[model samples]
Target: MASSRWIRPEVFPLFAAVGVAVGICGMQLVRNICTNPEVRVTKENRSAGVLDNFKEGENYAEHRFRKYVRNRTPQIMPSVNGFFSDPDLPTN
Candidate 1:
């Protein structure tokens, strides 16, 4: 035959400790749910969107660098045959 006592004197403290721990955890869970605001996953908030914007800036930088290079390219040859040879070239 088994004893049907709910709280055995030897194990009552252990059961109480477990119950207290579970209650504390449950209270924290409820508190977090109530206090935390809802978060939405929008396109602007996504990492991929952020990275895309960075990539766009990188591309713009590259474009500006290429434009700078193009502007700096040496114009060794004159357009007209006697343009550079003539001393009377327009001051403009």
Candidate 2:
């Protein structure tokens, strides 16, 4: 009668910790999906479909870091973005 489990009992704590971390992340994701204004669509706006106004400026941020950096220069790589987008291309 070889009654030995393949998964070692010593690894239970690791599995437990991982499970807790995953559970917490899942809970926060679900909460955000359900309650966040930017995520949830209003009943009146449902009919608008693709044409609905996003009003991104009025949406709530998930963290203070985002709120603080909102109006600041948002370009990740301004040089790349402005490659051919320059305003002064006096005809050659």
Candidate whose TM-score is highest: 2
Q: For residues 5-87, what per-residue lDDT tens digits would candidate 1 score against the true structure?
A: 65578888999999999999998677445432232255454434323355645554466447776865366565464486887
Candidate 1 stretches greater than 4 Å from native: 1-6, 38-92
Residue 84 shift from truth in candidate 2, angstroms: 64
Candidate 1 clashing pairs, residues 3+ apart or interchain: none
Tens-place lDDT digits, model 2, residues 1-92: 34365377887898899999999999889867775655645787566555443454245443566778788788888766666688665544
Once fitted onto the true fold, the runs of candidate 2 whose alpha carbons sit more than 4 angstroms away are 1-6, 41-92
